[model samples]
Target: MANAISASPTSTDPGRIGVAVIDQDGKRPVQISAQFAVAADSSTRFQIVVSDLTDATEEVALFFCGPIRDGLDLEEVNQGPLVLSQAPNSPARYDSVLGDRSECSYTTSRLEPGHQTIVVGQSRYSFLARTGANVLYTVPGVRTVLTREDLGGETMAPLDPASTVSITMAGLPNDLQIAAAVPQLPDSGLPSWSYEVGGQPRVPGEYRVMGHLVTVENRAQATVFFAGAFVGISGAAVLWLIEILVTGALGGRPRGEPADRWEQTKERPPPRS
Candidate 1:
């Protein structure tokens, strides 16, 4: 394994770089964790990693693409094609080589709702590249890790999160700035991958029909708690007038020790469908 595979950007891309590391290990199931550093121009760089396969000693074809739901093209999958920028001073680094998407196996669930089509993109240490005749190629990066190119690719079975990727963010431009700073990760306790492979449970837990319409002066109106994907609600609560959701001085540097802000903490109810 060479230690780190460098990332390259397109020539015509004149946008400034947003540096950040998206990291994860093979502790749990195949899950991804990411922390984004948004640049003023919103040019984002991501590091999707699966580490810990330094002990992987099996041979199997692997995948590196996303399981896109609605479907997407190569150009649409990545906008900068979202490459990892390797600055010499970056914290993250890799010792394995990237696997070509051309090698991975795929299975498509026909027109099925919540269907899947995996398109493994930029990957490392994953030996998905196949030979002309359909056979698992072999290579190693580290001692027992897959080779840079099997000429071919890895059977490092049961990949740990640190499967084969060690991408680093480098050459962070001197002028880069964070657009939005998240003081802490939210406790939402939800998986990063939004869509459930199989559609959500018919019901996550005990279910009951709740809420009802309020008829004031015979003008029926009701508020809702939540709505479903294709569900809709029409004659919900009628607001007296167009209302402001949040009010605060936006943009421009503030003056004095601290500026004041007016806020309404109450959230408008989700309309009943």
Candidate 2:
């Protein structure tokens, strides 16, 4: 497809147009109409805008597909069509205020320079407050050792507390590391690990590890304080798409670079009805 190229406007091929989903609410997601255009040598752009803005963490996601057809909605097609499982990777310019646990993530999939996929995703955050008296304590500043679990996209759900799982912990303080020895599973069924990152050892966020399940002992219950800013988690999407077009036309790289599929590929569930 790269062989056919020329300076004439009519000489270029209008490669497969793409679909874009825009999330204006950053909580709920909506799909925008598809767009198509011919690339100078295989360049095109599509923008999916959100019509609603009731949420503060509004974001967008983009997905690429072979072509739009009525059957496109029939099944989770994983064929040749590249399925960018997450949002774009560019730093998100949050036009709204950020609260605790509020985060914006983008995928690094770069659809063909001119040919690309566009989808929009939004983020919403909700926190759970346990029934307890609020207490604050100050301590002498001490160097804190911390351990971080990157998880690398490992799903924490559906894990058995009785079973052992391996989680990757990064950004560790030189003095501390995940005890290579098998750590004991909490009687509550949640897995816990300890390590020091920095700061006073007792400070929160000092030691962190991704556990399959962090069950409270003898409670026979699970408490998740972090609800996904599930606002509107979208698939491979583009942000400020208009800026992208302007930048490209002004003699910038025709399109953003594609990300390694190994990283973009995610543990996606089957499409829902």
Candidate 3:
């Protein structure tokens, strides 16, 4: 069977890309390890599929935070609609939802929060685009090992500190960055996906959450497209006005000079409920 593709954004290429979140013990989401390659002049797109594996319905929103240097704040960037309804009829189930809400990118909504959504179940996310091209780099054999070392010494000895180690990915675009947040806590010493799908715990003791990027996928480039669309609409409107002016279709004296935008466009009074 074909692997189920989750919420992902449109790519510059023709094929579909996927984001897989492996949830063991039905807990916090873990993005799987992936590798990407780009030719010198070629460009690519990425989509992040975030699978919500709960039977009960809930409102879901995606937030981006940071390494302090990345400077991403959830409130400033989340201007567009973020809430998606979790129901049988919601339309996000389809793939390749595209468009930019702001500096962050997203395509379509794949809201399929249901009981059947299980291991290998996916939800797609997006990567911020640079200029001509970028690579979605993935690594092989490397797993995020998260370990909590217990101080097994007597009271007299100092307690051993548990270090949270995260394996980092290198060779990405300089402007790109990563932010991770956990949705749940670890249970037994094993990851749930390994036990349920692979029939054994992948790690005997420790594990780390792999760090990856969901690119902005080029806000400036996307703006060019939006500009083209706006110009097309404006051109059509201008043409219509000229026809009215030449054919005497306005049927009245010309209104005073077009109100300068500096003159507040007359505010419409609020509508009564």
Which candidate number has the best lDDT?
Answer: 3
Whose TM-score is greatest here? Answer: 3
How high is each candidate's TM-score? 0.18, 0.17, 0.24
Candidate achieving higher TM-score, 1 or 3? 3
> Ranking by TM-score, best first?
3, 1, 2
Off by over 4 Å in 3: 1-136, 142-168, 179-201, 204-229, 232-252, 257-273
Candidate 1 Cα deviation (angstroms), residue 173: 20
lDDT of 2: 0.23
Tens-place lDDT digits, model 3, residues 1-273: 001111222232222221112222223332222222222123322112233344321222221111110222111122333332211211232221211112222122223534221111112222222222322322112122121111112011110111111222223444433222121124542212221112111321111222223233355446667999999999988987886586445343234435464245445589999
How far does residue 183 in candidate 1 sit from its true spot (Å)? 22
TM-score of 3: 0.24
Q: Model 3 misses residue 244 by how many Å?
A: 4.3
Q: For model 2, how big is the CA root-mean-square deviation?
A: 35.2
Clashes of each: 32, 34, 34
lDDT of 3 at 183: 17
Misplaced by over 4 Å in model 2 are 1-34, 38-41, 66-273
